[model samples]
Target: MVESAPVAEPAAPVESAPERVSAPASEAAASIAPAPTPAPDLDPGTRRGVPPVAAPQPSSVPPVVESTPAVAGTAAAASVIPGTAALPVTGGDALVLRGVTKRFGSTHAVDGIDLTVPAGTFYGLVGPNGAGKTTTLSMIAGLLEPDRGTIHIGGVDAAAKPLAAKRLMGVLPDRLRTFDRLTGRQLLYYYGVLRKLPPAVVESRTADLARAFDLEDALGRSVSDYSAGMLKKVMLAGALIHSPRLLVLDEPFEAVDPVSSSIILDILSAYVAHGGTVILSSHGMDLVERVCTRVAVIVAGQVLAEGTVAEVRGELTLEQRFVELAGGLSDVEGLEWLHTFSD
Candidate 1:
């Protein structure tokens, strides 16, 4: 009885601290977050947030880039032009030559060559007298056949499709043999008809050329009566009248007067400015060096060097390079006595 009195009301065992309350599911989940999703495969060492590597896929589709075929031998002769590489033709490149070659009996006029000419480029072809510059140009202009090679003009294959390729080009050969009896205007008209140009267009172009080349005064005159410079100008005008994508000239300034030469140069420059391509062959290194964006130096039916003016010239001046590469001078020093008077 005495012991029970002391324990009096030992508080009904303070209800074991209200059973400890468990944390809510949301709070517990946040405390131990799921391991971060592993980063996707990508270029190694790249920073986060950068684009991930594209996954590989099995497919039969070919890649977008295709390899270009190699050109060699006569088949590669078509690419023998200078400056043309930088000036692509109107259809893709004004011209292309791949493994082309031409032979005249024992002489291989042109060896394997490759060339590309972009539209609106002023190109110069320079070489010694027999370096095949003319032969290469003739092949490009469709005047000469390559023994082996592919020639394309504005994407039209010259050998396989001569007519189409010729339509895009105007050629002025070193020797311009025309119908001497025909008047300058009549000659142009005849060529216009051959080219199948619209009558109105041909007429208008002819008139424009006449005025531009100062040929209006000579329009009614027979070609046979025209002076050398006049004939050259007329031929140039004829080539330009068709508005061809390419103008090919071989020794255009030869036998021309200074004033006429300047005019021709101005016209050619203007044509290029208006998006036309020009391929000129000239021994006048000064003229070529002054106007050409690029040049090709050929020697004995092969390309000795091909590149921009600065590239071809390198450390030597254009004149110096020409003299060195063209063999030796003609020994003009031996003729110095021509100026001496007998005592």
Candidate 2:
């Protein structure tokens, strides 16, 4: 019992000391330690996977650019050209005018007109008896000079360069004067020569026109012996023999028969389809209304209105609009003698 007691007391006398604690370092002392070595060539300004810093640029340096001397010169030259304001002309249309005016003494036959005929367009010029339609067309055809304006044909200046402009045009004046003694075929031949068309082309075109116009039988006869309709057909054939880019006509259907008129209209339509230009003047408003893609209506030597037929008429009928704008045909309609029956 005494040995057991002694062992228990010894075990009780054994004591444990408190565990030791580590002290925290100051922020300034931690910062003084060297940082881990950066990866090779790593930029200090960039984060992981980011691009390296760019070299500094000079603030006074200007941007680099290429120059276009030829293009710049062309644009500058085009700006200086007269009539550049008229239009941005292109293609092979026979006639164009801008601000065109013609005055015969005090009569302003045409006043400040602008016209553009695209290649392959059948354009109509229409107006009352004394309207300036004819005068406007004449200036375009180079038959008369405009008091103030510019006319271009196939990009050739009409005023400054008449010959080159006229070369692109074929004209049939309102009152045509032909040699009465010459036969129909001979007349066409003469005009073909005057136009300086090649002989082969002249021959082929003449033959085709004679057949198309039903003038083969009358070709050998003198123009003086032909009827009014026949003469008109002959003159039309003459006007077309050279295959001009632009064909100008004044009242091409005046003396033509219904059958001939239909044929001529078809021919003109085909001509335009094949890249030819046609500027025709006619008092037959109904025909012009039917066939023209664009029209200019002149009254008292001034353009009263211009546009497509449907555009100009708006809600009113073309005939009604025509009457309203150009004055009613009441004076002519008032004639009562023609209705009287003979005894």
Candidate 3:
């Protein structure tokens, strides 16, 4: 049973601001020293009363990078290129990609990346900006095609049998746009229908989602009027309407209020507990460490490391490990002119 969510800490009011004080650069760095690695006992899943599963051991595959061109258009409507080889999948991984590569002009966004996500795992993907995290996810979600290699969702070849593969997954990309003219409820209904769900079932699911997302009062209003946080919630609701076996989310918590973030976490935790898989990308290392059972650190279009949170981050915080892997921590150079001033 998931423990009840804690009340969100309210933001301090504007008038409560404190005066700023000048500090030495060394002192500043000291004040922000990487927080101690959170105690394993405090993992959010365990805090929520869910017995955290033992994370699988790290993969031994050395990281490799390869280049190819980006495919055009959205995953939902993209046509598979002819002669794209389909790879056979063994075992029961929920998602598998072999030699996936994508290029944008002269830049190779994703390069010959291979990944395997096991069933019922809460996996997190972390990388620096422009590191091809989104590109790789887009390909896996069938929104784009890899110039080389194959992708499989639940053992269904996404390139050769996209419709079949797509039916088993829900995707929430970094950018989401809903039909502005449709009411929030209408938007979910549309997605339900698009997924071929029965009308009666769609209605029932839509109601449940609206209540879960706390959008009951806004259901009849045009989605165009919803706040950014509300929009995210509604889009997420649409993603879940079909009860997909896998979920692919890129930065699902960004721009969300703390309360909503907690709600989303609870929903995702429950989903994973019930045998679903989720692969999400986020810059928030703290949140990733708190929730994800497994994680991969990607840099320059290659996965530098892959394993359970504790395994990859051994003796270090995930943020520290990520910085070390992506680009080793270095002291600031040539910023000697920065100084605090007061009248």
Candidate 4:
């Protein structure tokens, strides 16, 4: 029998704060059970003329697409933000934040921040470590409540209508924190059922997702038995079981293999092409330059620059611009002792 616990899903409609899971070591035994029968109701919503994804890399995978100004992204008819970067602000309202702030004790993780992501666009968030990218995304995913400021999801006020807002989004949190005791199939089942999808639809989508992410054989095993890359893939599968209007993914390509990462990018690009919106944070500047229609660079809890890929990078590349805004590289004088080994 498998060890059982409450299936901790991604961005469920929990009234209180979201419960986080601590992933432990994998178990040895697992039953090779077959997945439920699949049907054609599963729609990943793949379309063409989408963003351009990055070439595959072995260690780190990035879904960085290269989007031109004429990419024809999400509906651009929404309201313009207070101080968004210089771009033709087109697209329906996917997410909007004004004066968003968060603090941990005395540390201000996220100071006053404003962002607007249009529906159907692949938006990117780039920042150095500890730059509040995760904090901001957490707030957007409804995992952490902001100290002050308002959040709107597709024109729905998140505070007043949390459940409604959550229904419109599929969130992939930073770490692989979830109910590891259950089989991957069981976890995905809960993820869909919690969102109120019919059992058959969930089953069908589970098979589809497993096939797409190459987790067909592993779906019967407990999530705890999954490797880092496998865990990322399974959790991602769970996140997409429901065809949500907006997807909030944090560092999704981390730990995934190059082939899997390419598959993920194709799926996301197609989803965006068919009117779904995605906002994710990544450190891959090249990936961001290739995959994102618009990007925002956060530094010290503030956005230094925000605009279309072409606009933000200007004459310099995205990496160069990011380094320039992040204060460039520091001197290596302090680490000189390491070079002078006591031979």
Candidate 5:
């Protein structure tokens, strides 16, 4: 059985925060960090995890990396050059988006955002609610059409040659919807089959992924019986079966338990080390800062900052920098009625 989550000491409030203090390590961390859970034993796979409770990773000074500018445009639509090649081609960049925009009636969910993710990078996309993070990811995944701009996946235009582009990617949507009646094994088998893998290969990979994700015992149970964390794990396993070059995941770690999150992180780190690219959206600033090689901060559908964690979060922690870029935590004043409640 997976060990229960660790209980770390709570952090002091921001008002009296210390300068560069490392969070005390959790007792469970020592036991969990060892060989009980090894990295995924995969032949090869694609894709890319909570309060991942353990030692709180501090965002101390990171090495300086130059920023990559993503300029916004007032224009509603972008023009693509006619006769451009749409076939898949190898490129140094794993993904690129230029002047991307998505409109929902009057609202511009994603407004003129530009981003480039290099091959083998673990990139994080972060923003507050309705900041176009999801919208931007959806467009890249080909779930939603952008009003303007072009997206390329491994140099294959996502909009112009969507099928070819999708072939290079594995996506874990923010909303988790699946055949809940199916067993975890069944789900993974079906995923592999859909990816055109032979049954024999799918079976072998399924067991490998299940063991890595600690779902070996749960594989027989229907997905509906699984907890939120298990559901995420199964879906993540399904996403990786095909071994696509790029993984576009949105909120990949939300609601995940600490143990599962740690396993997933290990798997992703290994995958990136083996030359896979991951672009994921997350709300955990510290987690992103620690795991991601690059990060992009989007606010009001515009990229406010883009670059290495060091460059964007200069003097402050990632959370503090995000709050500053996101309009500085909305003046906290008027709640006098709450102090004198009816109770």
Candidate 6:
């Protein structure tokens, strides 16, 4: 069973401090079962959708559809229906951050970061280590509060109407965990129900996702026993089960096998094709260039540049551009005395 945790209360004011929303304890401590040993001559049925070890690498996955900006806050209109206490956005970006800031003791982890994400866009957030990418994503996902600034989803103020704002989002945080006591299928079922999906619908989607992600054979095993790659796959499946309007993922490809990574790429592409928005942060510059239509480079807690990939890259590759944007490395130093060794 997952443990419960307190949710962040509304903030004092945008001018005072940022607000953070904590995950329920159950999610924070969840675990997955270990992967079974691979069979050299396994067939499709026995493999349960797992691609053969010799399957094409992740690079072979096709590029997702090219994304274009959508009227940001227009979708919020649907939130105003009887049961929802919608955000107040009218005609703006789907996601907006104005002067968002966060601090820890004397350090400013994120400083006055402002961003706008259009609906149905595939946006990437890239930064150097300790550049505040994770911190910024955490705040945006409502896991941690910022010290100052305002956040809006579909024009609804996130701090003021978190429940409604969150309902429209599915998040896969960098440090996410799952319920260790439950099986893979059980974990997805819990989240679907928590998101208020109908039981039959939840069951059907769970089966489809398990098959798609190649977790069908392991559905009945305990999550705590899963391999690192398998765990990442299951968490990803949970993130998509709700068919949320927006997706927030951090280092989603980390630890995943190449074949499984290809599967995820296809899934995300299809989601965006149907109008879902995705925001992701990764160190893989090449992957970002291949998958994202828009990109943002941040350094020292602030955005260095934000625009279409072509605009940001200009004549330089995204990595070269990122190096220039985030302050490229100085000439190699030290180890002057090092010499080649020979047996």
lDDT for each of the candidates? 0.59, 0.58, 0.62, 0.64, 0.64, 0.62
Candidate 2 clashes between residue pairs 3 or more apart in a chain or in different chains: none
Query: Per-residue lDDT of 1-343 in model 6, one digit per residue for the tens?
Result: 0111221111100000000101221211111111111112223243211111222223221111111111112123123222222122123366899999999899998999999998767899999989998888777767677789999866667788564456556677665454555677776765555544445655665666676677889988877789988877777776665555667788889888888887777767655654567789989999999999799998999999999999999999999999998888887678565665657
| Tens digit per residue, CA lDDT, model 2, 217-323 | 99888777999889777777666654456777888899899988887776666555545667898878789888888887778777777778788877987667877
Off by over 4 Å in 6: 1-92, 340-343
Tens digits of per-residue lDDT, candidate 1, 1-343, equal 0000111111000000000111232221111101111122223243221110121221221111111111111211114211111122233466778888999898898889877777667888888887888888878766567999898876777766554465566677666665656678776765554444445544655665665566788988877899988987777766654456677788889999886777677666755654567888899999999999888888887777778889989898887887777785776777878899999
lDDT of 3 by residue, 254-331 (tens): 889997787677677756654567899999999999999899998999989999999999999999999999898677
Provide TM-scores for the models.
0.69, 0.68, 0.72, 0.75, 0.74, 0.73
Lowest-scoring 10 consecutive residues by lDDT in candidate 2?
12-21
Answer with 2 or 5, whichever has the higher TM-score. Answer: 5
Clashes of each: 28, 0, 5, 11, 1, 22
Can you tell me which runs of candidate 1 are displaced by over 4 Å?
Answer: 1-92, 330-343
lDDT ranking from best candidate downward: 4, 5, 3, 6, 1, 2
lDDT of 1: 0.59
lDDT against true structure, model 5: 0.64
**Against the true structure, whose TM-score is highest?**
4
Error of 4 at 337 (Å): 2.1
- Per-residue lDDT of 195 in model 6: 45
After superposition of all CA atoms, the RMSD between model 1 and the true structure is: 36.4
